[model samples]
Target: MAADEGLTGSSRVTVFAMFGVAFGYATHHLDARRVGDVAVVGPLTPGVEWGLLWQMARNCGRATAGEAELARWVLTQATRAFVCGSGRIAQFPEQGWKLEPGGKRVRFDSTYANRDQLWTGNLTVEGLAPDQVAQRPTIYTV
Candidate 1:
């Protein structure tokens, strides 16, 4: 009976070890920023506006399952808004502003406690080239 019990215990240990390994492997490929307690990215274009950018970054921090992906998407959207000049009153009169890619300047900040949540940051869009735009935004997740 003792021998049988030992075999069972060994088997359980092996199973647990395997599970740990598998979990580690899966998490390895995930984005560090997403999995981390805190993350920040971007100089952004057009100009990073602290108020809106901070709100968006804080939201990203609070994200869960797909936090990294969501953050990347939000950055991309903000960039588009900058270039297209959608968020600000200043660019409204310039028809070229619409073609300019609206809001290129933005930043992201993410924070995780038990769950994910966005933290505020200082984002200000001031002197970026109006023609500059990001071809692609980076993404990562855990």
Candidate 2:
């Protein structure tokens, strides 16, 4: 969890990855937005630092329902849509996504999630050992 804390505490590269993007749609699905809830991206609302809302989530020792919802959307809908959108480009130099020239998509996603169901897309190698998989399994066991 050290790496997770480090990245969450401070990670310029992660922030840099979100630098430029132009989408007409509003964040957090718009309708879901409420007082003290600021959406950073589609269905992704980052709890404000030092805010009461964030404090509650922190004190609870897990993401609030809103954050969990956003996380679900991120791993499933958001990331799935994003990866599928690369239908015309090369994900890696060796692998092209074009439908022609024998380019095919295996529909794979490498995102890490607490619950296996959260990653609702095709399967591909994510560079994780069997025991290492699901490293952050959901805290609840219902």
Candidate 3:
């Protein structure tokens, strides 16, 4: 996952999409600033590892109780709330996210942590394969 604002790492976009704007609100609910140009790449089916997602969510619950609480609240409010305050218009054009023709891999440095919370790093997650319908993900860190 990458954003025009900067780079962070996670494959939560698919699950996050379910919450729509509420997901953004849940993610940045404590911050006054908004996000911009967020993008993610991963398989939707055949490769989307749902088990991994569930494990991640479970791990999140165990590691960050406060965040889990906020996520729960946001999920419950997703249908009725219009969470329009958490994101801003992207400064870069959509075309800037494209890769060369027939390209199938991308490389970037991003944060990673184990589900057990024993290790973490800003290691390069190289050669990621974007799904057929997804755009190339970009990682920009300051």
Candidate 4:
């Protein structure tokens, strides 16, 4: 349905819920990319499928009130990181980068260099505020 509503291609949906209120509403952050509809709530954290479970509540006819609020928050807190080969290798076994767990640092791994093996891991996205971190899986294409 979201695709019918102009969400073509692919998007990464990040869904989160706010507590404290009696009946708080959930929010969805859509990150448009060429990958797929990869929805992430949290790692080792409780979550819900806002789009699949509460489609009617979302009221597709109009925009959700949380959209603006989430956008503002994302703009202020979110950070994007890209990892790839250095492309400086003049030989068959080129150097590849390995991202650290926190997504703050990366190092060169010879074992997986030159695309010998694939490296899969989780990227920790820290918010602007201290002590806030969200874990997102690393996705790449050859």
- lDDT of each candidate versus the true structure: 0.26, 0.22, 0.24, 0.21
Could you tell me which residue pairs clash in candidate 4? none
Give the candidate order by descending lDDT: 1, 3, 2, 4
Off by over 4 Å in 1: 1-65, 90-120, 124-142
Show pairs that collide, candidate 3.
Answer: none
TM-score of each: 0.23, 0.21, 0.21, 0.17
By TM-score, the best candidate is: 1
Better of 2 and 4 by TM-score: 2
User: On residues 1-142, what C-alpha lDDT tens digit does candidate 1 reach at each position?
Assistant: 0011100000000000110111000000024354423222223333433244434444655545254455455444433343453332222211111111122322244432222322223222232243332222335222
Which model is ahead, 3 or 4, in terms of lDDT?
3
Worst 10 residues of 3 by lDDT: 113-122
Tens digit of per-residue lDDT, candidate 4, span 109-132: 331211211211222222212212
* Model 2 error, position 1 (Å): 11
State the lDDT of candidate 2 residue by residue for 19-121, as single tens digits.
Answer: 1111111111113342212112111112212122223324444444554443344333223333454211112212111011111111113323322222111
- Deviation in angstroms for 113 in model 3? 28
Ranking by TM-score: 1, 3, 2, 4
RMSD versus native structure for model 4? 18.2
lDDT tens digits by residue: candidate 3, 1-142:
1222323343222212221110211121113443421222211222232223223334545455443342342233321222231222111111112111221111213321111111111111222233322322334211
